[model samples]
Target: MDPSSVIWIFFVFLFFYPQVLFRYRLLQRYKFIKQFEAVRKTRAIVMIHRQEQLALFGIPLYKYITIEDSEEILRAIRMTPEDMPIDLILHTPGGLVLASEQIAIALKEHKAKTTVIIPHYAMSGGSLIALAADEIIIDKNAVMGPVDPQIGQYPAASIINAINTKYTDELDDETLILGDIARKAIVQVKEFVYDILKDKMGEEKAKYLSETLSTGKWTHDYPLTINKLKDLGIEVNTELPNIVYELFDLYRQPVNQRPSVQYVPVPYKRGTKK
Candidate 1:
């Protein structure tokens, strides 16, 4: 072959390889989702996010639940039959309160049973959505987090408390304004949480949970373990299906940087040697 032709062929291969690989992975995900739906007889919706490298720039971009996510999820729920169950595969570090609440409310209003499956942690708004589920299936070691409202870079409860401690004359106008907004935000979120949980658990237990989770009892990022959640009277089960773990494998994070953790990717039986 001529030198020019060889170079052109190599460039064409490089250009098409990543696109082909990405399409193949997407197909694999859809296949597994269909399999899971067939086995469980439910509409399976995935809301997972990972830090992915952008094409060309290779810049890592983190994803969170957004308005767009809510729109799509809501549509998926609507398309499901009234009696069909819904299985939401959730994995996120939380996101916008409006988007999360929208999704949570939609799930809560669904006529059929709604299940939230957390293979890992679902913090902030993610936890809010999980609370709306009729059943929560999580990995034993996975976690949920507080739903305390945050205002800008500060916690809403903290802002209100801090303002209350200070003399009116000593606080700036912006501080006073922020405090007012913070109080409203906290009240709004607490009420929303209570509304979602009241029917699932009793009103009294729901009130306690709403207060504990939304009133800044802990930091927004605090991990609520399976035991802690159970202790708090939230009945979350640790019966994550094997297919969920397998599906998570397909949503791998971008490999633009050195991976922090490594392991032998195989199962071991105690009695049988490899």
Candidate 2:
């Protein structure tokens, strides 16, 4: 090839390189999303919690379920046809109870079958949402935790117990007030869990599981593995399909920083004076 032609081809390739790379990455992301939906035979929604990171302005960003997340989930449900099933891909340490309940209600009310896939651990409020699903699928290593409500950092049951151990005269006004609130919260959470489970299991079994899970029989972070859930009469699948693992792999966070290439303009030099 002629030197001029070679130079022209090099410049043209350089001009379009970044655009080509960007389009390729976009296509890859689209393919992964579509593949997950296709394999599951349902509309897939992912709720993964990323590690906390600092934003561009140095503000801390948390990746827990929030009210905004519930709004987005509702929006997605609205966009999907009523007859279409949904598969929720959950990978969270759980978050706000109110937010989780909002999602759980939406999922329960969805016209089609709903399934929750726990790729790793879905604990606390996350378990509440999973209870709304028709079926729960988890990897062998995946776990669900007790749904005992927490007020600030204190477990509701613990607060109530502390009050019970003290005489009425020994309790201060504030302690009595907090104990009352905690007792009410415990009842509310147990009732919510019972309602969610009643349709899945019979009312009797649902009531049993709900009380057991919400009354702090186990620590808040206790892992309910697939076998344990099965023993509790919950419909749980231990063997995850290959496609589920593929989706999990797609959602896995990278341990290392992403590499980037940036263009730096060459400094222009003036001829030195002799």
Candidate 3:
């Protein structure tokens, strides 16, 4: 074929071979270096969801293992240069707390100077994991939610039901039982948040945050912002370097414009009983 004709054919081929286009995009991401190239070398990412909703802004991703697997986590640690610093990126709405906790603890225990980076929202159980990191970096637009642990969404609803019923129809034995469950849940969640804060902040501040967090009103309390974190004595680095800030703002554009800088989800089974 003539050179001009060959170019035309190549364009048509690429139009038909979309997977090639996708592979090309993946190739770009494979060697993708953040503006702060040094930081990307030792970074880990994790993402999460309750069910099959992996798409943030309708970007096609995965349902299960949407974040890093255990092996991947180890790989990130191992691949990181021994002398370089490391950062763990988390974008989770608080999945299995135990799983989140394990990841958080592992990141914490790693020998490298570790930092937790929250580019968007990390709430509930996810916040617990963020607490384990030595330092936490929350972008100006990013937020870490209150770590008020609960027994999933149903039991909490059931307890609320019992309270409403008790108020409407006076006390029944069943209502009283439900009341007990609700109270226990409140206390347990309170304690859980407290314990998490204790590790990140200290005992006194953890107690305060725990009580404030359980109200269900402050699950994603970003308004408190860095002030609240400071109150807890949780060290937060909110002011990013100007260049890093520029890169972060660029990376946060819609998925089409920005590659997924999200957690590589790992295969994780949700609790059947939960």
Which portions of model 2 show Cα errors greater than 4 Å? Answer: 1-28, 53-62, 254-274
Model 3, 114-177: lDDT tens digits are 7777766677666766776778888777667765445545445346654775464577777676
Question: Which of the two, 1 or 3, has more TM-score?
Answer: 1
* Candidate 3 Cα errors over 4 Å, as ranges: 1-18, 33-71, 78-84, 150-196, 214-224, 241-274
Q: Write the per-residue lDDT of candidate 1 for residues 162-231, one digit (tens) a residue.
A: 8889899999999999998999999999999999999879899999999999999998899999999989
lDDT ranking, best first: 1, 2, 3
Against the reference, the lDDT scores of all candidates come to 0.85, 0.76, 0.56
| Candidate whose lDDT is highest | 1
Candidate 2 total steric clashes:
0
All candidates: TM-score: 0.88, 0.78, 0.60
Better of 2 and 3 by lDDT: 2
Candidate number with the higher TM-score (2 or 3) = 2
